[model samples]
Target: MPLNSYQHPCPGGYQIQAADMLIGGTLGARVNWGDPARDVVITAGHLVNNLNAAVFQPGAGVPGENQRIGHVAGRSPLRTYPSSREFLGTRAETPGQRITCRYDFAYIEVAGDSAATSYRIPGINDTDEPLAVRDPIEGEPVHWLGNTTGIVLGGHVRDLSYWMTMELDPTNAANRQYLSVQPLTLIEVQGTMPTRGGDSGAAVVAVNDRHIVGVHCLGGTTRKGRPFTMASRVPASPQALAEGSSSAGFDEVLTWIARTKAWVNS
Candidate 1:
């Protein structure tokens, strides 16, 4: 079957389909445990919450035919922040329902079977070497691994420090209720690395390298009609992850996975 026929976006890996397929909507990220002894995956909370009845395939080719890994029963609360009104306006809203801004991310626990074993990416086993988060040097090659175009799309980071506003709806009464959103980590790319509806939640990794600097979470067209991508830093510092570890959070997600799941075989 054509890859686009599948429900999820693509990055072309045995586990990519397995992990991404279990997520709902077009947004979800692929995560590694940084340990080979145990198996784990991470994604947005909204995606997993909508996946209660979904089955997780471990190693199957294509989007929907992977081996059953597990199901997402509980998830850390996390919300996907869109980059524009057009994107948010496209979503369905209901009355009396509250949207969560915190914990917009979640982690999946996988069994240590052959399928999980085969999903390993070497040199990811060590957590000691802190991942690099250097600014993209001009003319330096970069890449993003996302389900864009129903497959993994890669391109160089064309520009940096790009900024734009998006729409946001607050679920709580405290703080600013509604406002336009802005992000600093905007990126541009060339070639056929077109991002589409389901490409959110991908990792913006350095090309030919294992360093993952940002997460592909949003996209939009510029005033000039050119497409661009946006991301938030993974927060390399321990202190930063601690502060924003709750909603629209990553620190809590990663730390939660570390405590709840046995990613490293003891």
Candidate 2:
């Protein structure tokens, strides 16, 4: 929701940066899960995996004051549960074979005067509103604002399935494995506006209303293995392995927040 004109200030799409890196994803949200006093900023897990990366408003490369905001507080594990019980690949044929999956999220506690107790996007629900997580509808339009890409419109929900992403060496050998939010719970979107590397934690909001369907994570290609030519450039994230774009839905994020409540510092 743009205020005044089609261009208005949206607070969530801030910058995420490592020491000398170009930049990572945008800040997804500022939230308090269930506790009001505990303030935290949300973004892709890979962005803050280094733990020492600094977050900047208007991002690092953007031409602005580029104020430092906070540091990474905690991040969910790349794998939240064991993939197998007795033997490896034994459950490959099981109905919910991807049950142990969890990836792509980080909670950053605001430092000093940058702390925001409440956060909201016009098309997304107000922070004061109760959480209402919903599955993305295929073919429905979605929206998001990113620090690098700005406002992206006319994006379509592409897929909702078990997503497994791997980062491989140049030799094509696997280096890392990332899980979906849960068993077959990932939201894939195809937007008319291109998503670059720095847009990774941007909120994927429903075009018609205030429902945050997913958080932007990976950006590279379409589901059919086509390259995204519209993008300016991909982030230098270790997870960026020339793969398809995807996201973790709200269902998985909210659930993880509840299960990991004990880890919250505030």
Candidate 3:
């Protein structure tokens, strides 16, 4: 489903549009599938912590431009506390219980209608595969499918690490949380494809097999001034599934969409 400049293999996947009512900004990444009843879209806890509304777009380009598929709500509250250090007097942290930096992940329920359209990797028939820890070998070419440079593709895996840091909240040092120590991977390209502002929550999948290994969580320059991309691994453990409920926000979003679809059909 290639359209315009959006050339990713999974063009139909959901893109997380940050606080912008419109699609076109660096937001969070859409990761994790909580269960069949609720489709979990993982993102930075801070993104949805103070947001008024969160919707899922099945297609690329713009947020509201496509079909209104799903809705999302902040699962937990943001934790703000004071720091002992003089330079950083106040520190705000998201509690792990309420979706904190330890995981740096939040789950959003996908509406019914939208679920059918959201991109799914070819091999992901069930959540049995251990996605949290992928054994991707070094030099194995990988690609990222997201709203990169305006929604195109053709990037390669630059490197893999147990952990890395990206600028989440620039103003507050406390806002920055150590990215969960998972098998985090990076994708790089020359001259840029089409990744632009509003492609934050895109998925980074393996090209050949099309199995989702990571979610595009953040992007920025390296310490040496080189450009790079980053993504968080999806926890494959059942514990991740047991922690959150899928009935409330996620189910409600899907129920509303189903009702709308029925109304339109009538």
Candidate 4:
């Protein structure tokens, strides 16, 4: 609970350890699966889902060297998607509803040179301009950079189509570890800015454009306990919104990290 650097608007916004509870998000774009110069750090499989736990950029009391940013090389498996009819034409507006699209996400793997620490996702600007990926339009106009809501500029997209998240599985037992409503191809932003619960894996761009149209995960108040008001509510107002998981769900985690990268490089 110590944030600085203007609430971590850079260096990918981190903090990890879900078993003992310390979660925040964002830290994307630095890919390359099998050594085209090696780099890897995208996030959000419920914020690193305990791959032994240690990621901390600008996190854990705001310092340096808590900077352990790597390890969990891949995650995203708890499937359940059926927005009724089209898991095969590859979706076309088929929100017939069945729920459980949990490709939450995760990709750590940076072990030397700390993945070079910058790919311009911090409040959006360092200028290599590459990070592209799309699909999220229903109102469009989104932006993000969060440790707990630091650069959320305008955020609008009401629903790119299909959503039903609930997620929170600290290994089940806290009442069977929730992932309840389930179906999410989500892009759902809404603004007046103030995302909470460590802003789980923020990235969401597309306001001025870096292309990326999703990553930030889960925010609430659509009637469950009543307290979610993005200004006057109605980005599609079921009540409150702020979700993400579509860069087309990171192309199936980059095709399962390029088909296991030779068992992660043997």
Candidate 5:
């Protein structure tokens, strides 16, 4: 299905743009791990650096009305520690500067009523099946519905720990910063779908049971010029958001939404 266009009860795998940023990324998944029927929008950390930033859909031919869907709720620092994310730079990175992170994923608290969202991932699992989450298994076939390249298939987890840097580059009207992250359980996929811009934040899923696996964070050529597609493994544990890890890249973000987040109002 064409996901770039506006969708009511916006499901997973749709285009999302931060109102303050010029570019956009995919809202990888609609995970309702709370009391609400449709609770949060999950995506890459860089897209939601500023918590509470307004978020909307960049749908073509769709009128501009009712576009403001939600706001950034939480994010995990993509870099830190020999055991976990702490000590060193633990703040979420911003655009226009290089970032060091351990887990490159974040979650947005969905606003409005339950009708405003759906957990279904179009073309992959349209039913209201209980969405399961897990870490990516190497060599297992996978699928991800990207806003730019819809319904990507024939891919499998290749690398569970790949170091790389992510950047928006020049010409982007907003967020022209660089992101440099360590291995941190980076899930690399190699196969049919050639990762491209706007595909960032796409959720990497297993083809067998459609279990949510990883967050497609970024992709690019290595110093040797070899192309690579990378993602952050889905949270196996979000304990204290990795603040207690004595080793590096051991935790992933998810604790904030595992329970409804109590937003601290100013």
Candidate 6:
């Protein structure tokens, strides 16, 4: 459960949910999903499957049942496969398809009369315009927020292409077990960022201009035991995604955002 919760309107930096699973962040209630352009919210794609389509605020069974704010409208795929080769992990492995690995994002369709939402990240955004956003650069100071650690600051983007091999369930005693070795490209945050299990989809904001650059995915210790955080570059304009470094795999939602540019605030 949330130790602390922000008031309504569903702005960035607060807690959101998918059934009982605590997810976070909503870029804004703006984005064209279909016929009657519905409001759009952003988060990690892995958390947006059909089973957990209904989104609740605070939690599923919190103060009341009216906390549902949206449903899964679209999601970038997070595909994985059986061990192609014993390249990374011991035992068995499910390496992510290179294309889906670097693109971990999803969209939520809010109700027509839902409470207001904003793209602002409190303490980070200054103006009323959408949260300034782009990809993170190496060695740049950064910030991120989530239910686990709200508003972590003074961290740097350590690496832009760090790959990992992770256990399907880390809680198990086996450390060599692995699954979903994803895209080789990832934004690595320097130092232990204080993020925990609940902070998976947190947005990594660049200190300069407070740009929402990367989406927080996973964290771990270096071989020497130093901490580091990994994130995927935020999907940007179609031009940026095609010509820029956002990689492939976000074309479905990104194309919609580009086509409906006026309504989207990403």
Candidate achieving the largest TM-score: 5
Task: Name the weakest run of 10 consecutive residues (lDDT summed) in model 5.
Answer: 257-266
Ranking by TM-score, best first? 5, 6, 2, 3, 1, 4
Tens-digit lDDT string for candidate 6 (91-110)? 22232222234455666767
Candidate 3 weakest ten by summed lDDT? 81-90
Model 6 spans with C-alpha error above 4 angstroms:
1-6, 20-39, 62-66, 81-100, 111-116, 166-193, 223-225, 237-266
Instruction: List candidate 5 stretches off by more than 4 Å.
Output: 34-38, 59-63, 78-99, 111-113, 169-176, 184-193, 220-227, 236-266
Tens-digit lDDT track of model 2 for 110-185: 7563533236643455455432324466666766666666555336654454333323112323433334443222
Query: Which of candidates 1 and 2 is the stronger one according to lDDT?
Result: 2
- Each prediction's TM-score against the native? 0.49, 0.55, 0.52, 0.29, 0.71, 0.66
What's the true lDDT of residue 166 in model 6?
40
Q: Each candidate: how many clashes?
A: 13, 2, 14, 7, 15, 0
Q: lDDT per residue, candidate 1, 54-168, as tens digits?
A: 3343233555464444445334333343433322342234311222232233344554322432322122313323234433443345555444354555555644433333222
For model 4, name the residue pairs that clash: 25-201, 26-201, 26-202, 80-100, 99-183, 100-182, 100-183
In order, what lDDT does every prediction score?
A: 0.39, 0.48, 0.41, 0.46, 0.61, 0.52
Q: What is the Cα-based lDDT of residue 47 in candidate 4?
A: 63
> Candidate 3's residue-wise lDDT over 107-169, tens digit each?
555555343233433223223332222435544555554434443354567556433333444
lDDT of residue 57 for candidate 1: 36
lDDT of 4 at 100: 38
Residue-wise lDDT of candidate 5 within 1-266, one digit each (tens)? 44687777777788888766667888788776432343677888776657788778753223574466678776665432232122222335322232346677777777663465677887777887547777777777777877877766446565565554455444653534554454433333454346677887887888897888877877643322334467876544444234311232212322221211221110
